[model samples]
Target: MPAEIALLFWPLVTIALYALSRVLYRHYPSAWTSPLLVTPLALIGLAIALHAGYRDYMRGSHWLLMMLGPATVAFALPIWDQRALIRRHWAALLIGVIAGSALAIASSWALASALHLDASLRASLVPRSVTTPFAVVVASDIGGVPELTAVFVMITGILGASLGSWLARLLPLRSSLARGALFGMGAHGAGVARAREVGEEEGSVAGLVMILAGVFNVLVAPLLAMWLR
Candidate 1:
């Protein structure tokens, strides 16, 4: 196939794979079936079969990534909707985001260090705990590969969602606030989905916490980048 046609086709393939993955997950609903897990694997397989490198695929799909910024901004509406709850639990939400973001960064750094990964990989790992849009921004700011950081974010989210569910069940996280915060802090987007499966209030709180954490991480990323340098 011509390069131009291949570029266009790859983007469609990527989108179709993701859409199909979501459908499969809706029906078969498990960690392995999750779109975050299956879409990437399917895309990788397709790309490999087509001899398409990351750059080739990204050339067409970059627009989707650009949409992330607007999507992240839209998260603010959730905060506005939950203003009353936000006012009541301002301290908890604030403290939870701070602590969660810190721990996530520290743990990623330590894990990368322990593995003796390169500095760029370490930087990519730093924002692995946050969602994609924030992680991509942080990655670029901190001399990490945004694409690599996005992959790490997906892996972290899948694992976090799985573990967050288990923890919610095992731990005495009785309150909606605690349960929602637990998933939001632990898993971000994936966690919010799982939290929604549990309850509406939990879903709302999780979404708020996830947005707050993303905004906080984006704000702190510059300082963190400088410190690393």
Candidate 2:
């Protein structure tokens, strides 16, 4: 393959696979069909078959990662639409964010400790519960590998989204705010998408909660790191 063609390959393949996965999900609607699950796996398989290096694959896909900033900002539209809901439930949202962030950090710490991971790996795992952008930053600030943190974030998201779905069904979460917070706090970006699937209000609340959690973690991260030290 020519240099230019090779550079474009993974990005093009990623976009096409994601689109196809979305179509499959809409038609079939199962965990197996999830674009979140399918697209990356397909890309990995393709890359392996073609003997593509990780650096080359990333060179093409970095642009897509940049889009996440705009996408995260776009979530503000939903949050703005539900300002009344937020105002009415400010106390609940505040409590939930605080508690959820604390628990997530604590659990990450415990998991890493149990595994006896080194400090760098332990730091990377600490911010796995938040969305990628936040996790990446937090990991860096705490002396972790940003790239490894991103992978952990994705894994955390898939698991959290799945767990949130199961809990939503099992628990009697009558309020949209409650349901939204459940996924948003647990899964971050993936949870927000899943919350959106559930309802507009749920999605909006989930977006708001996810944003809040991200911001909270970011602001507290420096202090948290110092305290841990």
Candidate 3:
């Protein structure tokens, strides 16, 4: 294939695999059966079998990454639609965002420090519960490895999805809105996705909380990093 045409090939292939993974997820219906887990594994295996370098694949795959900004911005529609609910729960939502963001950073930093992880790793882990784009920027600002930050974000998401449901139930809080807000503020995008499965009201609250959490992290991480230093 010509070089220009070849450039599009890998990206198309990745998209197809992702679509297939979504289908499988819908069919399987297991907590472990997430497209995020399956799609990357399938792509990595294919790349290895083809002897394709990760760098080369990334050159094409980055198109998908670029869309994250617009997708995030689009979430504003949901927020606008739910403005009434947001206004009603503004105080609780604000508290949840602050507490959740702080807990995420503090928990990761303390654990990593206790385990004697290097400074760079600790920095990367501290932003793990925020959205990936914000996390990457925060990690870079703190002199952490963006690649390591991405890995930590994925780990945080998986842990949240797996355990958040049980944890929410254990809490005395019976309001789905509050429960979903807690999960989204603590887990970011993955928790919001899980919240959608619970109910529409919960999902709307989750989306708003996730957005607030991202904003909180971006605004506060730099200050926290300075304090830690």
Candidate 4:
């Protein structure tokens, strides 16, 4: 295939794969058995087997990535739609988001330091629990590699999806709302989705918390990075 045609072809292939994954996910409800997990790995493995470099694949795929910012912004619409609930619990929700974001970064940094991860890796890891687009920008601003930040975000998502529910249960949380907020703030989108499956109230709280956390992370992570440095 011509280079230009390949550029167009890869993105279409990725979209088809994503659609197929969603279909499969409907059949396999377990986090460990998610099609999101299976499909991406398959596509990546195929890319490797085909000898397609990351840069070449990214040339097409980056268009989807670039839409992340706008998609994130669109999440605000849901928050707006739920403004009444937000107003009613604004104080507690604010406190929960702040506390969750702080714990997510601090705990990761502490663990990474104890594990003897280098400073750059530590910086990347600090924002791992936040959403990927925001985390990548924060990592870049902090002198960490955006690519590394993205990898960490994926790892965090997978771990959160697999263990977050169990961990939420283990915590001394009284309110399902708070539990969901913590999950979303600390685990990003995947956690929010999982919270939705758990319950409607949990899902609503999680969605609000995820949006708040993403906005807060984008605003605060660079400052935290400076302090870490």
The best candidate by lDDT is 1
Whole-model lDDT, model 2: 0.86
Scored by Cα lDDT, where does model 3 land?
0.82
Worst 10 residues of 1 by lDDT: 1-10
Measured by TM-score, the strongest candidate is 1
Q: Count the clashes in each prediction.
A: 0, 0, 0, 0
The list of candidate 4 runs beyond 4 A from truth reads none
Taken over the whole model, the C-alpha lDDT of each candidate is: 0.88, 0.86, 0.82, 0.82
Give lDDT tens digits, candidate 1, residues 1-39: 688997689779878888999899889989899888898
Q: Sorted by TM-score, highest first, which candidate order results? A: 1, 4, 3, 2
Cα TM-score per model: 0.94, 0.89, 0.91, 0.93
Cα lDDT for residue 75, model 2?
Answer: 61
Candidate 1 vs candidate 2: the lDDT winner is 1
**What CA root-mean-square deviation does each model show from the true structure?**
1.4, 2.1, 2.0, 1.7
Q: Which ten residues in a row have the lowest lDDT in candidate 4?
A: 28-37
